[model samples]
Target: MLVSNKLLVDNDCPMCKAYGACFTRFNLVDNNTISPYQKTNEAFVNDIDLDRAKNEIALHDTQTHQTLYGLDALIKITTHKSQLFKAIAEFMYPFLFRLYKLISFNRKVIYPSANTAVGRDCTPDFNLKYRLVYIILVALFTGVVLHEYSVSIYSFFGWESSWFLEIVVCVGQIIWQYVAVKAFRKKNNEALEYLGNMSTVSLIGGLLLSPVLIIQSFVVLPVLVLVGYFFVVVSLMLLEHIRRCKLKKFPTLLSASWVLYRMGVLVFILTIFI
Candidate 1:
């Protein structure tokens, strides 16, 4: 159609600010042409609702006299020039829309770290698919570790061992933690974030055991094991506290339950190899 229009974006929005650059990077749209919504957004915000215009990507086509919002707006602008991006956007639109809503819904919890004065980096991604991919990878890595440790033990008794139980335990921890959180106090919208955070912190704790396990190969280091356990426990508590504070929830029962389950998992696995 070759219809001409400038993309209007909320300057205050972190996503809007970031996407402005993305348009240029994709080479589908020029950065200069994508105008801040503050100037012209007011023109059509009443039609689309001011909040909608600010929260989602909004485009005002001066030539066609039309306005587009949300993921559609992004697709229209970026995919116009590239069939590859267009196809990709179609494939991931549903997931990306959900991810955008997650971030939009939980701006308070995720944005504070990016303090302008302190220059702390922002953590903006809450893409559910990305989180799923991450957790699975972590779980798989942990599975490999558990399998190796289990096989080593079986060699002494000349008995074969399967990682089935160990793999289940490794993956079960993440699911159990989510169930605990949902059971105590459900934050339906934050479920993905909850799972993602749990997986991330658990993976970190699991990695800490890697070093301790390596040391245990030569000499039994009880002190190191205790220290590793302490670090992992403290880390989980700290993360839960921050998560609660950010989500404006005061329920610690779920947090405590999650911690207990993780600690239990660690102990159970330790007994298997030790």
Candidate 2:
């Protein structure tokens, strides 16, 4: 009972975006017609009567009243071109399905689902490359910003300091951050992933530090230091709690602790001479 070939897709998923092109290339559609599930009314979209569409790449056969999602839909779309591909797809489905579920899980975290029970197995998509690079860049950017604040404040107070050594120490701290994480977490499983995760959490926590530090230098506000410390602590605590609950044997706890100490140093001005 195959109905007319109208491939409805969750426009929100990057995987579906790729699959949509497959539909066009195979002449499955005469026009570009992938409906973003968020806007699409699911009542007309066959077997997925509820809105599980948001968490999965849904493809429905209106005639058969059958629906496929994630790896199933991908296999369906590719199976027609070659039996070999279908076989390969079948072989890969177990792993791909899990990966797909993981991506779906992260996506739902950002744009929740009407059906929360879906994608229960998907873990956090650490997004190692992008997150690692972002964390590195942010640290360097924050370093420069803090350097300027240091020079200004120290100069105003008639003190002398070697900024070159300070810069070297700051960069060293970032590098050792990775080492610390591996040291603290006993398992050493997914060390790079843990490092990336910790860096991501730390960066988010201190995102406001650079600007606030610069501002405080001019304004002489007493509470700004505490505010910065609060930001970093909230981020650290959030990550620590997440690790304890989700990744019990995870690495990077030591590195994260060191990062907390470094962030504290940033707020030390308010700590002393009070």
Candidate 3:
């Protein structure tokens, strides 16, 4: 099952590293063929488009001396493994390709690398367009989840449920975090990365609510149960926010500010706006 090809991945990306290791461990690629473009010799690196490879992984054919990239390279390895796997890969090419691009484009911000090596770096260039896309999509999801949750619980707290309020709150979070980052006088890139991570936390909380949302579609749960679960999700989101903030070496007070914004917004919506 050993394919005679070298797969070059970003050593800094945990996803990429795990991908390469999985290929090697599963005998999908030859032993010692999974390499980091950063550490690979210039001769081997010169064999492929280094820039393109940085964005999408590169697979160099050791035997034919040819190169394939991104999903094509992945399909190539599967082609060597078995007809069934190869067929499945080709069948799901469209969805998988988009998913690959989404992950590839945001990999750095998804898990910012702390590696400051002096040698060649394989870190993908930060694409603001994709980063914004990620943020917007996450915001939309969060907004929808909040809108639905508010509808379910507003009556319990004697508060009016406004769909528009949920959307405003979601958008407000982005602005609030941006202001927080600016208050600390962070550089533009750092600010953008922090915003991306913050949006991811919101996204995580929304996803955690999804199952309960689905259940609510069929069964009306008690208000206290819904409220308690919401708080539980929020607690987890808070811990994750703290962990990611620490990962980026951001100030601990940033997490405090993050929680403060949500609390302030909740108070405003429940008391004044409603």
Top model number, lDDT = 3
Q: Quantify how close model 2 is to the true structure by its C-alpha RMSD in Å.
A: 12.3
Return whichever of 1 and 2 wins on TM-score: 1
- Against the true structure, candidate 2 reaches a TM-score of 0.41
Q: Which candidate is the best by TM-score?
A: 3
Between which residue pairs do clashes occur in model 2? 180-255, 181-252
Q: What's the candidate order when arranged by decreasing lDDT?
A: 3, 1, 2
Candidate 3 lDDT, 1-274, residue by residue in tens = 6566688888778888887888888877778789877787676666788889988999987777789999898888767757898888889999889877877888877766677644567877788888888888889989999888768788776767777878888899899888889888558877888888888899889999999989989999999999899999999999999998888887788899989998998788767745
What is the C-alpha lDDT profile of model 2 across 123-230, one tens digit per residue? 334454444455466556645655555554465556554456455545666567556665655444355555444544444444645566657667775444544565
Off by over 4 Å in 1: 1-16, 24-40, 46-56, 69-71, 82-167, 178-259
Worst 10 residues of 3 by lDDT: 111-120
Error of 3 at 230 (Å): 1.6
Q: What are the lDDT scores of the predictions, listed in order? A: 0.61, 0.54, 0.84
**Model 3: residues >4 Å from true position, as ranges?**
25-27, 41-43, 78-98, 116-119, 158-160, 272-274
For model 1, how does the per-residue alpha-carbon lDDT over 183-259 read when each residue is reduced to its tens digit? 75576546656655555555555675577567668865554445556566558646855565355443556567666
Clashing pairs in 3: none
